[model samples]
Target: MSSVNYYSPEGLQKLKDELQDLKIRGRAKAAEDLREARDKGDLSENAEYDAAKDAQGLLELKISKLEEIVGNARVLDETNLDLTKVLIMSKVKLKNLKNNMVLDYLLVAEEEANLAAGKISVKSPIGKGLLGKKAGDTAEIIVPAGKLQFEILEISR
Candidate 1:
């Protein structure tokens, strides 16, 4: 069996929509490019045809990978999430012990992570360290730069 991937509802829907677009419009456009390239010149000397074929190959590979991900994806509901500890989909407020800086982060799946939006992937160093931590608990996370300490202030849905 394939490994199950967790996703939020919106993230899963976005993936499905993208896959649909690639299979429909993307494939059509690729085929059209190939046809146009083939009409341009002799097969052996046609660089455009070769390039088109390469592009089509890459597109098919992307579609196949996306199909696999969508097939195994499980969308998680956030309403019933546990607030006892930091987990996927948890909104956590932390205070940096060393610098006294406060930061907020939402733990989410890798595909749905957007640092600019304050969402961090559970697989990240700080996210992994913060997982299973309760309020007021201190976490000493080892990041790429070095080890940093953070105190969990709160955990919510």
Candidate 2:
């Protein structure tokens, strides 16, 4: 069975849009490539044709995987979420205990995680440690480097 993944409404919409694009534009491009390759030479000796066929296969595989992901995705209702504790889609303000550096991160699904954009995957070590933690609570997260401590300063939607 495919596991359900939670996404924000925008994220889910983005995924759906990508799937639609792949099914239409991507398939069209693949077909055109095959046609161009087939015109090059005979099937037995045509390297271009073989490469085009391989490319088409890979495109189909990508489309299949994306379809599966979109089928299993559920959008989270931001309005119904609890703001008192950290959870998926929560914007958390954290204070590093060791260095006392204040940082902010938005907890999101793995697919939407972008550290540069201040979004972190809920499945990540720090995200897991912050889960269910309320403001003023301290979390000790074990990372590859070592154990790090952070105090939850605030939680917001």
Candidate 3:
């Protein structure tokens, strides 16, 4: 069974858009490729035809998986988020206890995690450690590099 995933409205819309594109443009491209491959040869000896079929199969599988993900996605209301503690969709400010450096991150669903954008998956080490922590709370987390400590500075939607 597929688990439900929570997303921001923009994130959900992006998934829906990708699904639509795969269903329409992606399928059209696959069909065109198959037609071209079929026109090129005798069925028994056609490598291009085989490759095209395999590509189409992979494409369909991707579309199916995407459809399932989109179907199970739920949009979270940003305006109603709790700011008292770190949670999904929470923008949190943290202070590294070791270096006294401040960092900002937004906790989000796994699919929407982008390190460059400062969005972390709730399942990630730091994100998991920060969850449910209120301002002024200290969290000790173990990451791949090593053990780190952070002080929660603030939490906001």
Candidate 4:
């Protein structure tokens, strides 16, 4: 089954651009490599040619997978997002109840998740637990370490 993934406008555009690059420059580079390898003589003993062919195959597979992802992606408009609860594309602030530490995160698609940037994938344990949670609500999320409680402080687009 092909499940659709949500992305912001910028994120969607990045995917499109990457796909275009792979289709154009990436394919061209692979073809050039194959041609260079083929010129190295005797196909039966051409290790370079075999390696080049394998590289091209891997590149094509990557391109195909990217095309599928781009085709199934849906762009989400942040301007129209509902801030009543935590959701994909929502910037959320939470307080760790036990540690009293506050953290900010932007819930996003799996491809867009970056820990340093505070963007967490909705598929993540904390992100999943935060989904549909409103301000003042406490979420008990289970992680690899253990279960932890967080209080939703705010939610914004």
TM-score of each: 0.92, 0.92, 0.92, 0.93
Model 2 TM: 0.92
Top model by lDDT, which number?
2
Q: Which lDDT tens digits does candidate 2 get at residues 2-81? A: 89889999888988999899999999999999999999879999999999999999999999998999999999877777
Residues 21-108, model 4: lDDT tens digits: 9999999999999999999999889999999999999999999998998899999866776779898999999999999999999999
Q: Residue 122 deviation, candidate 2, in Å?
A: 0.7
Window of ten residues with lowest summed lDDT in model 2: 74-83
Prediction 2 global C-alpha lDDT: 0.94
Q: Indicate which candidate wins on TM-score.
A: 4
TM for candidate 4 is 0.93
> 7 in model 4: Cα distance from truth in Å?
0.8
Candidate 3 per-residue C-alpha lDDT over 1-157 given as tens digits, one digit per residue, 9 for 90 to 100 = 8998899988888889998999999999999999999999797899999999999999999999999998999998667766798989999999999999999999998888999999999999999999999999999999999999999998988
Clashes of 2: 0
lDDT of 1 by residue, 1-157 (tens): 5687788888899999999999999999999999999999898999999999999999999999999989999988666767798989889999999999999999888878899999999999998999999999999999999999999999988
User: Every model's Cα RMSD, please?
Assistant: 1.5, 1.4, 1.5, 1.4
After the best TM-score superposition of candidate 2, give how far the Cα of residue 98 lies from its true spot, in angstroms.
2.2
How high a TM-score does candidate 3 get?
Answer: 0.92
Worst 10 residues of 4 by lDDT: 76-85
